[model samples]
Target chain A: MKVYRLRIAVQAISFIILIYGGLFYIDMGNRMPTFSCAYVDDRGGGCFLIGFQHMLSRPFGEFLGDAGIRLLKAMGIFALWSIVLNKAWCGWICPFGFLQDMLSKIRSFFDVDLSRFGWITRTRYKSVKYIFLVLLILIPLGIANSFFGLEKIPRDWSVPFCQICPARVILPVFNGDFSQIHIDFSSNTTMVLTTIVMVLVALFFTTAFVKRRFFCSYCPMLALLSLFDKIGLLSLKKNGQRCTRCGNCSRACPMEIREIEEEKVLTNLVTQDCTLCLRCVEVCPEDKALETRFCGIPIFTASQQGFLKRQGLDEESHTNKNGA
Target chain B: MIKTVISCFMALFCLFPALATAKAAQPATFMWLEPMSWDAIRAQRAKKKAAITKVTGGQQEAPNPAESYSTSQDKGKKRAARGARPRSYYLHSGEFPQPDRQQSGRPARMNGQYNHRAKPKKSQTQAILWVKYPDNRSLSFAPKQRGPVSLFSFPAGDGGWYDLFAYHDQGVNNDSRIHRYSYTHFMSHGDSVDKHETNGIEGPGFFKGQPILEIKRLCADDHECYRTHAGQNLRVQVSFKGEPLANQTLTLITEQGWKQSKRTDDHGKVSFLLIKELFPEKIDRRKSENYLLTTEHVLPATGVLNGQPFHHEHHIATLPLQVFPPKSDWQSKRMAYMVGSGTFLLAGGAIAIRRKRQRKAL
Candidate 1:
């Protein structure tokens, strides 16, 4: 089977497992891992990363004291996942990422060719995820400080990033649950916060349908995953000396990550932004030009003949094109 | 290779926090607080059987609270230890104290020698009842000195649980120090008393009318706080029949480790205003948001409690704070559901139309 087909099957299965894994009727003695979406604000009940973010957002004193242990446990759990899958969690496992991919597929089916942002624009947009990560941590710190008799910070500011997460709005819709899209009229703070959430939810739907993986560019989880991307087992490798600068890899990249096109290093070709989707490796036309590896063992390498075969063109058609 | 080694080391180092903070397990105590009848026992068994069959389908194991706290290895030890102890036949169910309405007549000046200003040389005092409700509302009273025991009635079928804590001094017997004892009773409204709801079990030592340190949240005018909002300034009073003597310090500690202390007034009441600020974020709220409020006061002067003489040292009580359902608006819930669904459908349709138009143009 083709790599894309395999990826699609994996994505479908992963999405099902992530979302509906809670539906099983298990006995009290037995238990299952609560593997919900990280971007979702499940009030720290599930999702290791979200729980970590929420814990860090607590007051310094509280966190340094009793909650410190809990924060460490949550962080350790998230770090464990990060070491195992790394950015594969985003490319193949994330329900929200899969949602964006489905939207892009729909866009492609309609023959809609959206313009990729310039390299500079993409580079500037990359920083937004870091900003989101910072705010996700800072807001909780504010709440925690208020808890220490510092100031009466509104409790509604509890999980700030979760209030505006596009997945919070999008993923719930798959189950016919759209309650997250409503503006909470409970308090002034809730009203303002929920209104922002509704607007962002609407904005994400429209943008993601038109522009491929638009929300992933600023996902806090992606930013967090990027921090440990260097230590991940799966990687993308580039042989810059063999490159003809054909730019096929850059064109194939949905994230518009320019580092893969620009990288000179042969070993550490997997940049922070690379999701290890291996689209770059698949599209690289030169022999031994690009490779995907697991633990320094090359799993798949790009070749001119393989690329032609993937595009449904046989050697006969290739020779005819060369003759023309 | 070194980089990878360093990363693995860092990851392992992170695991240390989890290991270091792991709490040591406490010994399991016999926890049946409410009385049970044979009918209640059969009903409980049937309930357990139904739950077990429903869960495991055919598994023989019964649902046990001890299982939730410990591993399967510790389960047998817990069961064995539990079986070894004699089952408690009854709980010291007492009358709810009433508000003071009348003044007590003074003892006819025994030879004008009993110092009114100094600590009583030999007086047998009854235990004090303190009740704390939601909205920071509290009420407390010395059952004997106060005019009458205030009859506080909770909303009988309100579907909320009320925590009834009774603290009395178990007089100094073998030990030189005064031994204080407390009972934490969780009385849920609208539920049959026979229903086996297990909180943590206290040992068999705690019983009726003994010299002990009793501290409790007072429910004002019998208004159960289960129906009020949190963060109200409530008072918690501490007292004992054995006058550990008055004017000594009593320190109150919350579950969050927040501590506040107050000296007992001449009337032997050490009342502290509990300014409820932030909710204990770490603990789960569904099972119980009961803030474990504990107080330990050392006896200042040796005094006689129920004719049993006691010396300095040892008095402590932990009152778990129970809260009522906060007021919420339910009318907006339907509107929220409608708006959310409407936006989802609208967004879906708009995207489909736009995609179709682009396809047509292609």
Candidate 2:
């Protein structure tokens, strides 16, 4: 079976559900681990980051009571959802990710060549998402509580990430709500945050033409989902002794991850940046070299015949034709 | 004889001025409900104490309501110590109307203090009903005897608009009168709660029996209808016994005592553009200002009530709404368009140039 075909179908279905499912009264709750923006008036589910930021915006002392319990419960629910499907939430469910994929498809359809980041640049940019994750946690806490005798951060900084997220401005447009496009001149903080949002939104459009899944590299959700990679139920596995290391998997990777081809000894191939798209498994030519596992059961595996069949160069058909 | 006539004329002129002043000082006779936040009440009490201190040459201090309401119980002392504001609203009469702002352009004097912990009157125990929207369930409050200013608290289990209706019917002399006061409060729990559950429902007929005269803000499927902002065209409908009350005078009173009067059309609907009185600098965005909308209807009827014949029945309805500062006061959509378009163009141009250079390098 072609994994890419199945993935595209799944992504399309997930996009419709996340974007327009509220009209059908399908509420998946607000603890989703994907970028289903809450700003959309009829959203089926909501991203957890906004609620997490709001929950963090309380006095540190208040966390000892019901506030602490509430935060724990929310985090637990978010973590459970993250662990079930792993990073499939990114490649298979996130509406923002689906949007980026569609843009990349459009660029490809126009025969536009994709650009590649330099090796040094790619390695250096790996920590960007972790930095964003850390700041997302710290900024809301600072807004509510004074740190080291300093004054509390201004109220304008509440939900700081949401104000700067490109999805907050882009996702609502699909629902015919353009109200989020305005800049709030209420305070200095709001002005700065909203300006950043505008710049990021603009960059989101331009960068998608040059790179595939550009924003996912800097997404704080990816960094969060990476924390549960070890305990996740689904995983990608590699066989070191499978003999040949063809670079087709690495060449076809959307995220430009090279460890899938380079790492020979690591049995678990689910790296921090690996979205578990199964592109690597589909492109691997050697038999039993790469496979995706769900709770110790192999769902799909790499084989020479399957790879050749997908490429329309099946040896069985060629042999039969030659014999005839 | 000329000097005596001049002196009498001067005395008569002085008496005329006194009579005019007396006429102007007549108190407001309407009974309306006012919803005050705990923070506003505290600030008012502090201001009153400061005024009292200045008047008495710093020789005396006024008693604080917080102190007066505190009990000898440890729990009560702890609550007072925490300075926890009441979650409920206060009802007050217009006799001593507390204008949000004085005629001299001073800040609003929220001087009409109502003890939120005080109970409702025993005679009018069933007069007030708290109606929750979407489900539209009318909940009854436990009765207790208290002062004229009553405290109203409801169990806001869900997030939506909770309408508190205070209905009273009394016989005065040879006529009967009905007074209905309604106040809607929006309770926001979080994003999880469905705030638009009450959007499809219309008018003030959510309950089983409608009031004799009712005034309801007309909002057609707007999710933000729970909040009324300045500079927005506010349309209100007045109905008498489930039908439109046409040609009725509806008066809108602002926090600063600015009143605008308009007559309802044949459809019993009146629209008014709420003036932008609170500017960005002077307004606290976290707090909302209260605006009172009132309309009265007089029906000619002859009825015997309490062994008295009534010639006319008067029905007065007041609806208090919380209005936020106008969006235009702080948000600039034009500036946003400029910044957003500029960023998009600049970024797109830069990306195009870089792609061209890369193509050349290849």
User: True interface contacts reproduced by each model, as a fraction?
Assistant: 0.10, 0.51
- lDDT of each residue in B1-362, candidate 2, tens digit only: 99999999999998998989876765443445566665766587578878988899778745423343322233433332222222455655543335423433356454444334546344433334444433464444422325455565433333345566656554443365444455454554443344433332223323436555678778874455766778888888998877998899998887666889999999999998988764446445556667778887877877776667778877777777778888777677787778878887998788778889978999
lDDT of 2 by residue, A7-88 (tens): 8899899878888989889899888999999888788898999989988987776576445766798899999999899999
lDDT, candidate 1, at A98: 77
Q: Which regions of candidate 2 deviate over 4 angstroms?
A: A316-324, B1-88, B95-97, B100-161, B167-178, B191-213, B237-249, B256-258, B261-270, B278-288, B299-313, B355-362
Q: How close is candidate 2 to the true structure, as a TM-score?
A: 0.78
Clash count, predicted structure 1: 23
Model 1, span A208-270: residue lDDT tens: 777777887887778888877888787777888888888898888878887777777656765
- Model 1 chain B: lowest-lDDT 10 consecutive positions: B94-103
Give the distance in Å from residue B362's predicted Cα in candidate 1 to where it truly belongs.
16
Provide C-alpha RMSD values for all models, in order: 23.9, 8.5
Q: Specify the poorest-scoring 10-residue window by lDDT in model 2 chain B.
A: B77-86
Proportion of native contacts present in model 2:
0.51
DockQ of each: 0.05, 0.40
| TM-score of every candidate relative to the true structure | 0.52, 0.78
